[model samples]
Target: MLKRLWLILGPVFCAALLVALLLVFFPTKLRHDFEAEKRSAVTLTAASFKGRMQKVQALTDANHRFVPFFGSSEWLRFDSMHPSVLAEKYDRPYRPYLLGQRGAASLNQYFGMQQMLPELENQTVVYVVSPQWFTKTGYDASAFQQYFNSDQLTSFLTQQEGDAAAHHAAERLLQLYPNIAMADIVKKVADGTALSASEDQFVGLMARINKRQDIFFSSLIPSYNRHYDQRVLPELSRLPDEFSYQELEKVAIEEAKEHTKSNDLGIDDKFYKKRLKAKLRELKGAQKNLSYIKSPEYNDLQLVLNQFAKSKANVLFVIPPVNEKWMAYTGLREDMYQQTVEKIKYQLESQGFTNIADFSKDGGKPYFMQDTIHMGWLGWLEFDKVVDPFVSNPKPAPAYHLNSAFFSKEWANYDGDVKEFGNK
Candidate 1:
């Protein structure tokens, strides 16, 4: 009986040992390269997935003057050459390193900041924050994984002790995706071991497969950017060049000309009105439970604040302006939103963050925004007026405030059109 048992268990033990050896020793060369094959086939162009950081790295490798400007898709319209415009306007050297991505929450931004901080300490950095980031869910890990590597995730996770928000984020991450190879991360954290190169590569491969369905046939696809040559020229980065400037101006003119003629873009005034009404209806009961203090987002926000405080980097936090109609529709009264913003401001102030510019209640004038949230060309100009000065001085700016009465009033057919902007 003992001999028979040994015969059966011996092969199983050896097989397990052999597999472990393979995983530890030859993970890369032995395993099939699914992610690379998939990437070589098809790639997504969401702000987070796009090659913005890679492009920024290429630019920064050549130009050391660029300072990272972190934000969401809301700031995507901000021209790369705007720094030159700022330099001219403020009569001070200005170079902004824009790294905005779609659906990026504060956690994602914080990670991006960490990646840049090694090279950019004590430099003036601009962060454009959206109020919506303070919601309960905070950030989606799957979305974040597209841009951030596993090493970043591991670092955050390993250093996340005593942080309720970070703990909760990890829990949420694990709960959302059960088979995330987190056990390996946890083991590494326990052993004070960094993930090996092959291990890191495996984690990355798993993330891409899980998030983007890279194993499937639909992964290999191609997309194009029109006027690629025009964009690549270094002259486009200068204000005097007038190439990008004219292109954007022409786009604004064309957009204005076709404004009244609505099609399937769903950016018309009526469409927004309808959506606003529906959102107002949906958020009626939900607003009661909403508080920035209790949000998981605030927890991650606290972590970010702590990091900035430690770095003592010159940072300017710009609160992007929100559309009044959208705010009202979302059941956020000026007073209520103001209270929330005040809490945020207080938190920042407590952390010794002096420079905060809240454009939250700018009333979302037609010329300021193309849709309910996204700023248009003229909208960016108005924002630049505020940002350009802040970037030049790197000092505290007065928060733009709106009276409580502004929110109480009802808006009717507020088409955000500015003839002045069009003529420019």
Candidate 2:
């Protein structure tokens, strides 16, 4: 009786263990769900940003045209005139897929691009270059670690040929997150050395494990942001049946006026009440000496340009401005800010990236900014004017001529009057 019972239970336990192991270790092949991708396209949550399935499917969808809107906290400023809302309300030819949130800077975007290289290839994309990201110290490591995508890291490390860009990226990754995950693999990659047979096998195994985890757990990712975007539907109803710039302008100014009345600073009422009301005075002249002229962020941005050139993506670069009142209160020097903008423009135009919508000098325009750094109702309208036409119609393909020197420390720290970049 004991032997018979043991035989039956042993097989059952063995079968259960096998199933569990397969569930955790086996790779999953995800299929396309176009309808589901509509929501995923607008879902700007970090989980969505870090994962590849949702983004790749939405980007490569045969039916819908989802253009990537890469920026930081500005994407979360969901007003009626926002690109997502305007596009949805107007029934435009393309939909904007937001890719960043607070704390997502240049380096964050560079690594995040690794997994979706195929999707980004030949894609028409927009990147909002924030002046604040050009701080002397550059990207904040703690913030970087919070949105870290291990899959992208694996892709970057394993596919590298010990090239200059790869070496720089690996070194930065190791330095940024001292206690970063997969330090052994990252350190080896940073050394610009070849991986051993066992290590190579281990990296591949980890990649599989990461993919398995993403597959089973992806459904649990939040859709709250997508839902939040749907609130624009009511606002969309308020628009005319036909598109009219005059009508939209009236709406934008009225909306901005109603929302920004609480502060003479042109900041949104709720934001001012919550974030600035307490320390309003203490922040005066706080940025008197703060500068954007020199930082390693320039090097990190080169990684993005390098990737785009390789992809041959037709790209649009947006330069956002600080609120004039806020800029004055903070005492940030205009000359210094202009120098940074000039440097940023030099980097882009020098690389043949010329489709730019520059609002860097429009900070003084009333109601253009929602707060200190983000675009409000009027600003988004101005953004739509340029962006809608670009994405709606076809254009000449990008003629990017990339320079590796932009990845060097000299360019990162160079404070010269950069009228032109040496595209050598």
Candidate 3:
């Protein structure tokens, strides 16, 4: 009986040993390890991630208090590298650390603050809030879960145990599974080629992923609409013969009308200028309701904001500037625009958030690029100028300049030229 049992078990035991030997000697695919390493490297090298971690470490090591500048990509585009503008304006030494990431919503910033709280004792925190941020649902927490450990995230979320929205975000992230197989395949392909090891490899991968993610998420999320106007519409209308310009034009006009009607703003000549004005008004009014503000995604955002405020972090909400050409195409009326500004002012006063800055009307011309929602260098410079005094003083009324030259007339002309060409 013993001999028979040994014969039956011997093969199984031998197979297991063999498998172990293969793993130890020949090793599993470098692709899997390489992919994991690549992901780690990307996370480590991310400007926002690295910056935040450094700040946390610096504070922890020195046992000194520091200021944290938090927001989304819009904040990152502002004076992150140099404190010169801040130092000069404040008349004191300043080292403002950026904790903003591209595509991150307000909830992400709030979560980030929670994670860094242990190191943030007696630290000054400045938040940059955009009107759009208040409308965000929550953080795409799953995206960053790989970079952070479960225990760390759990502890952070525990602070918001009573908040339903926060709990939902935590649950969603916990349920996410990394696409290890695909990640391994891509990493192998990246490693096999010289391109993978290039200095720009990580950046290139990130750029590609970001582009794909933007397209994917925009399609998935109902609220992530890219409102095309004279600036972007013209380009889309000029797409190669693969797309029907006539069809696109019809769609644009119909959509524009729908937007105007829904918002109770007037649409003239198939443009939604009145609606834009109304949106501005709504933004202005948001300042008045300190306890609750309506947004595209109000329920989730309010909780996030409340958490941040309660934590004693100064929040600076910034409304990104729109393109002048787009405004022209959409037809933003003056009275509507003025009303919007007043509402925003009221909201700021109501909330007692003096650190807020609105760049939505950068000299009435569009400050964003035609193809992308991102601000151009000129716009970024203007944003920097506006926020400079505040970062320095944190008490003075933030200054704003409305110079015509501050806008890119070249871009405006391009829009006009496109329209003329289209007409011809």
Q: Could you say which candidate leads in TM-score?
A: 2
Q: What are the per-residue Cα lDDT tens digits for candidate 3 across 27-130?
A: 21112222221122122123334223334443443332235665555433222112222222333334445556665555455445555666554344555554
Model 1: how far is 239 from its true place, Å?
A: 9.6
The numbered model that scores best in lDDT is 2
Error of 1 at 266 (Å): 12
What digit string (tens of lDDT, one per residue) describes model 2 on residues 1-424?
A: 9899879898998998986686586656656665566567677778887787777767877777888888898987877888877887777888888889798988888888887888888888899999889889888888888888778777776666677778788889988888877887778777877889998888887776666666556756653444445655667766666888899888888888889888799899999999999999999999999999999999888888888888888889999999988999999998999889989989999889999999998999988999998997889989989988888885655788888888888899898867534632
Residue 202 shift from truth in candidate 3, angstroms: 36
Candidate ranking (lDDT, best to worst) = 2, 1, 3
lDDT of 1 by residue, 245-361 (tens): 455555444554455244222244554556544564566445544543334555456556655654556677877665565455555556655655665665565445767877766
Question: After aligning candidate 2 to the native by TM-score, how far in Å is the CA of 186 from where it should be?
Answer: 2.0
RMSD for all candidates, in order, please.
12.5, 3.5, 20.1
| lDDT against true structure, model 1 | 0.49
lDDT of 2 at 43: 74
Clashes of each: 5, 0, 19
**Candidate 3, backbone clash total:** 19
Off-target runs (Cα >4 Å) in candidate 2 are 1-31, 222-226, 420-424
lDDT of 3 at 414: 25
